[model samples]
Target chain A: MKRNNDNIKYDSKVISIRNLKKAFDDFEVLKGVDVDLYQGENLVVLGRSGTGKSVLIKIISGLLRADEGTVNVLGQEITNITIKNLDRLRLKIGFSFQNSALYDSMTVKENLEFPLRRHVKNLSTKEVNQNIEMILEAVGLSQAINQMPSELSGGQRKRIGIARTLILKPEIMLYDEPTAGLDPITCIDINNLINEVQERFHTSAIIITHDLTCAKATGDRVVMLLDGRFKYEGTFEDVFKQTDDEMVQRFHDYNFIE
Target chain B: MKEKTKSKFFLSKKIDKVFIKLNDIWLFVFRFFKEVFVPPYEFKEIVNQCFELGVRSLPLISLTGFIIGIVFTNQSRPSLESFGATSWLPALMSIAIIRAMAPLVTALIASGRVASKIGAEIGSMKVSEQIEALEVSAINPFKYLVVSRIVATTLMVPALTLYTALVALLGAFVNVYQFEGTSFTSFFVQVFEAITFLDVFSSVIKSFIFGFTIGVVGCYKGYTSSRGTEGVGKAANTSVVTAMFLIFIEELLSLQIINALRIVD
Candidate 1:
């Protein structure tokens, strides 16, 4: 492990996975992978497209099940958990999808209210409105409360999506490609938002991305997934330090854009 | 012999895939039934979907139903004249519209219009990861998305059919009054006297079946749709096609059952 950062928080593992195996029929996406997410730390999982970065987070969130290993998330084994139990566990996890995944039919306020309405069922209308208002302000989109998803730009949509996730005040956040197809400045803003979310929400996170800049800006520790396993684990520089490996050098070539 | 075996194997594989998909759809429906009766009934969503699938569809239903009445009345008017029974026009047109045409036309339109809408809406939601977002939020996406629409369709289709029946009858009456100058009261009296209770009941029942088919097939296609634009397109297309096909099948089966019931009654 590379401890390049001066301040590295090492709390007890919020997510613990060991020998995780997942396959789609004949194609094995996650072949015996192991990792851990510490409390209040940002762990970046770097991989090219189809390297199962999304699969890993999906397993952690109990959205997808592992075929042949243990995925213990929030102190519960997710693979064999009941639906009701999994749902209870999911309340503690907030997943920010790559596409933002805001309900196109709903306005920003409705999108944010959906989770709170479900989980925090006892909140009065006034309280619900307050929560939505607070979340929108927190994401710096207070003016976008009445806006439909179609009216918003990609970055705005992403912010609303994050706000929606954060409304529940989850203990763990899972960001899947927070800045995949954005301009560099927007990417930086999203990266800053990730850091802000961790700091402000007091939540651990696993950010799955292929962007090296994002890895540097947000990741307290970086893990490079190659061919369904973590090939590099450490700081951003440490991941690319061993240039002798042809695959790592190639991945570095792709992500380290000028 | 090897080539023959390989071909047979491929066919078997295809059949197995279809069966697997069918099984999954059945399980999805069963799960929907299980979840629908559980607590926190999602009353608001159900009402929202009812408004979407029911009340919002009235104008289209009225237009199609009116046209069906006009076309059927105009085409069949001369035939009754050929039989020297022009007085039977109101009775025959009313019976046809109330029993067969209204249910079929309304269902076909519902299958074409509403099923595709549902499939595309849910398909887009599925592909865009909106459904999973709901799941992550601990919300029952099936209950919110599927059950609400199904219940709305099941209730509203029959209601729409009745509305169609009225509009269609008004259309037929216009044709009758123009050609023969029959009074409105007499025409309605003849219409009511000609049709039995079983006919109206059967038409409502068939409409209900059509509604259920539209809801189930549309939701299944959408919820199980693959990712991407192509998948969404396929889901919408298959939703309309499958619902229409099932509607026709149900129409035949229902007519047969109703005919048997007519004999008993």
Candidate 2:
């Protein structure tokens, strides 16, 4: 566990998840998980499937409650607050899901405009439309604005999801398996886009992934989750430089297979 | 010894099941308020949901209500004639329609049609991680799905009940005029005179509770529903059954409560 008491200077640390514990009928998924996210940095949480990586991020976003824990984001304690306050806190953090999670009933443009129209206050219709177009262009999907999510390819849908997250201009972004189902080239493109977004907006990000390639490329710092606890925590280079750990060695060896 | 162990195991398992169900109920009640008053209502998806859930359900509800009115009147007429109370048919049928039949029948239709639709839609959304996606997007799922549905049901079910009552009277009138020289104006006078505010109030209040129950049960089942298409089917089935049962119980209870309160007053 890393202590942040001495290093606390910035008022906006993006997110702090402390002692999160979640369970489903005695399954006990997350066990006392603690993490801190800072501004303008990409932190990738790498783990096997069903290892509580996504659960950690979900707790921070207030999607799922920590059975017993405190989640502080942008200086607000989310666990004890009312839902209205939670929503207010969430406006500062945007999220892109694994499957794109685009509204099947809506066109890509409508999906992009959903949060904007809901949360953004006092924006005229013209302004909302303009913002939509701006975000669509940023994600390089202005041409596919009218197309339904079903009509788009996997990569295009992913890009549209990214566009929807970015439209709110959030200070913090959470990505759950952003590059999971895409091709290698598309994965690289998404990683580059994430980096570009970080530089442009100075936004902090928490990326949940099992793909080491994605973790190394997108992560400024990386943490490895195993058996409901973080087994490794450091920069990408620090994690890759080791050979003693069996899982890391295996992951490294598998990357060389093709 | 084996018998004792077996009984103990069964008892503990039953207790565990009760505990879990109670937990789910409590969580949903907590989430109900949490989502309703929460900011950022997810207006776009909710509009889409209302169109899909409320507007699309109108056709089925109207069709069912119309059929129920026609058939129920046609069936009850011959039986009334046997008892020499054929002329009492107008008042009798009106009392029936205005008190219990209209609301209960409409609710059954809603349970089968609207409740199942809401349950299946939300269930599949849950299975596919769409609900989780909404939460991650900072959108409250309960407000987005449940409140919009409750509001829609609140508005539409009363309108549907009124439609059922009207159609039922029309069907009874048609049945009545087909045989004897029973005047339409006379039938209207008898039926309208027989209806007190108590009858009308009870039926309307019952339908409102039925609608609210359907919305709450359907949303609860679907939201807590597990993964896969099987889970979706289970949610839809359970929601319809739960809503139907609750509506019946509410009708019985509300009638008794109304009568008791009237007596006291």
Candidate 3:
């Protein structure tokens, strides 16, 4: 598989999350989870609902603090960084929200411009508009620029979310439930867009979703979460050939329904 | 025998849920302070929120101000006339308004309208996981959400109070003429003679504080909201009530301070 970043060697790792733990009250959601995201690779985190999949990704992105352990992203230790430094680190990573958390009151243009305006310094208004137009076209949302988020469909909203993330042009992208609420055709559309983003922008991505089609289409590696730990982590073939795991077999079997 | 066990199990589960929710809210509050100054400032979003939360809510504040001014004038006119102090209407009314009524009443209305609206909007966003989405994006939710809201309230509330005072004075003018056939210039002369600069300045400054308190407390409660729809309702309800209480307390404290200054003089 061609990696997203040509500047870095395929074997080099970009994100190293070691022994991460997070607990809400008495219930521990993640118990010593460790994962490494290689340069340019699309890693799909698959899990049942409430199995801490979102929490795991959140810790890596510096959104949620891990109860213990380390998250080193792009060679920086995120856990111990100062507030100012942490923000600088964040600008290098883009996140597409699960429910397309576009600012409801903002127009599509404003949503796309939100990060670009904040992080990009000395950028002319013309340059900003060009970037927005390019990202919007990439997400197939040129027509929806003036529209409010409430005016978009579920799939269109997700694409806008993706567009918003891409406007930052970060080294890494985190997608939380990017295809959760879309139809199959729409899911395919999103999957194609994700692949296109990886191919064109060469940005490393980690998608958190249980959609098997999404796993097969966009993921270079599938990591399943069960009981707050990774049950399986491997390529699609590695998962498909295995007969020992019932959940893997069930997912593989269900893939034929399409 | 099994029935008793089941009921006890359900009771324990309910209690456990409440404790966990309370725990989450406490943790979020602690986290809010920690993340407040972190960079990647959500400038565009904050400005947009300010326009929504502050500017858009101005109409309601003005309406309340207008009504209060008219009602105060109408009610106080006959009583002052009995003491042959009818000409003191503008002075007395202006003092009543600039000193106490405008800020007090505007804050109370804002507690009902803007505070509750903020609570429900933020509460819904929290439950829907939008706030979590913001966090995972490496954005500091506290600075993005709370600070923007507080700043908006601090700026808007005083402006709203000022507008309310102006509108109310106009309403008082209408009331005076309708009742006593007094011209507008005479009313102003009487009002100007009665109301000290201290009264206007004190009232305006107090309204600013009231605005800040309402916005901060309303956003705080909403940001920490839990328990689904029921929690959202509770947050909105408490935001208004707390703001109303704070406005009253602030007014009383300012009054005491003013009295102290008068006594010293």
Point to the candidate with the largest TM-score.
1
Better of 1 and 3 by lDDT: 1
Residue-by-residue lDDT tens digits, candidate 3, B1-265: 0111232454579787888767875675465456545554556656776687667877776677778889999899779888998877887788888878888887888788878888888887787667865665556677788777766777777777778788888889889888888898888888778877777777778878887877777887889899988988998999898888878898899899987876776
Model 1 chain A scores worst on lDDT over the 10 consecutive residues at: A1-10
Chain A only: give the TM-score of model 2.
0.91
The TM-scores of chain A alone, one per candidate, are 0.95, 0.91, 0.93
What is candidate 2's lDDT per residue for A1-258, written digit by digit as tens?
A: 121123223455778877878876657777888888877778899888888888788778877777887788888897787877887777788788888878777798888777887778799999999998988877777899899999999889888888888888888889999898889889888887787777666688999998877877778788888777776788877876753688876766676323
Question: How high is the lDDT of residue B60 in model 3?
Answer: 79
Clashing pairs in 3: none
Best by lDDT: 1
State the TM-score of candidate 1 restricted to chain B: 0.94
At residue A137, give the lDDT of candidate 1.
82
The CA lDDT at A231 in model 3 is 63
Which residue pairs of candidate 1 clash?
A: none
DockQ of 2: 0.28
Give model 2's TM-score versus the native structure: 0.84
